[model samples]
Target: MSRTAVYNLPARWLHWAIFGLIALEFAIAWTMPDIHRDTRPVGLVAWHLGLGTFILSLMLLRLLWRGVSGVPDPHPGPAWQDRIARLTHALLYAGFIALPLLGWANASARGWTVHWAGWVPLPALAAHGAAWARPLGDVHQIVAYALLGLIALHVLAAAHHHFIVRDGVLRRMWSSSR
Candidate 1:
């Protein structure tokens, strides 16, 4: 088998950073009380929103970097498996962008302005108490759950490549240099 080139340092860092941020977002969400419009955001809720914004920004940057740097060569595998892998990656990227927009829309519908670190208020995406708030919130939750499943599948696939297949596919993303 041929050796696979590892991702560049910036790519590796962005990938890991986004992964850590997503974990932090989940932690904040699970621990914090539900934020309501009437109540000012404090503690975990504030951290959740702030971290989410940061994640979104980083994701955008990652996408830009990906576009400029391009991906490593495709892992040699069954054609079907390669297609499946591509689809999974696309969904993950879309989720990174979609989930936050959904959350932002939900917040806007609730008449709340998202502030990053207790300052730098973000613009509202919808009117206060908009008819779409509840629906958007519900969709956001559903997508989040789906994203969690996708992440699990992603990790499982990587493990399969590393352990069972004994392919260097996993190492491509694991290392910062070729």
Candidate 2:
């Protein structure tokens, strides 16, 4: 490994942080009581909302940091593989940003006041009882499932790079140093 082969420290840090947070979000979502019109943000629902907000904030920060720090050059690979990798990464980023916003809109439609990290109040994305945004909850869940598939593809690709291709692609983010 060489310095140029891996992501910068901050990029790697943000990447793993978001990964861990999203994993936690999924776990909380699975155990949380189902959201209903009259449901109050308590217990796991509160945790889910707060964590979603935090994930959104972190994604934004990660995007900003990525813009500032850029990224390491892509490991040498087939052009098609590179294209797929790029598309997958783009969708992952979009999914991360969209999930929370969709949930926020859905929450607003349900008249829930979402807060960032359980403190800073976030503005409602939709008016209370707005029908248009209500469907977004379903969309949010669908996109989440799709994103999970994408993540699986991503991890498998990384493994392929490490074992089959014998490239440093996986190591690019897994390790901080050469």
Candidate 3:
């Protein structure tokens, strides 16, 4: 099969969709609890849950497609550069897996249904218990913070490639290169 040119269309959609969702998810995760109940935290929390479900579902599909279509070639760079890319991606994949599970667990522990949007309900991965969910939420928050930091680094590296290295790296994933 032909290797995709930079990102193929599906990859592009997945990238932006996940990027936006993750950013919004992080924002809600950090600030909701401190706000008063009369405020809008409930809606924000629900939106976060809905988006997290979307992220997790699309991620599974993306992984399947990645397995079938194969990954684009790693950008050519120094040895340390390649390792950084690999490690960053591993962390991302781990967060993708962890975030939703933690959210679901948190909801379940708090006696809320694991609802996917206002439609299609998801069953709890574990029985209801604060003992289980609170710490999972804590870990989820930590991982989300880590994801934010890594994303900043990822963006800087991409920018460095575009401006400093003057390579095709950013164009492959950012613009139409065909």
Q: How big is the positional error of residue 22 in model 1, measured in Å on the Cα after superposition?
A: 0.4
Candidate 2 lands at a TM-score of: 0.95
> What digit string (tens of lDDT, one per residue) describes model 3 on residues 104-134?
8876766666667535789877676668665
Residue 64 Cα positional deviation in candidate 3, in Å, after optimal superposition: 1.4
TM-score (all chains, Cα) for each model: 0.91, 0.95, 0.87
Runs of candidate 3 with Cα error greater than 4 angstroms are 1-4, 30-42
Tens digits of per-residue lDDT for model 2 on 1-178?
3337689888888899999999999999999998887899888998899999999999999899889777887778789998999999999999999999999999989999999987788899999989899899999999999999999999999888889988677778989665
Clashes of each: 0, 0, 0
Q: What is the lDDT of residue 163 in candidate 1?
A: 93
TM-score of 3: 0.87
Cα lDDT tens digits, model 1, 20-127, are 989989888889886555755667777877888778888889999999877777877899999989999999999989998898888788777898544689988888
- Candidate 2, residue 42: how far the Cα is off, in Å: 1.0
How should the candidates be ordered by TM-score, best one leading? 2, 1, 3
Which ranges of candidate 1 are over 4 A from the true structure? 1-4
Q: Which candidate is the best by lDDT?
A: 2
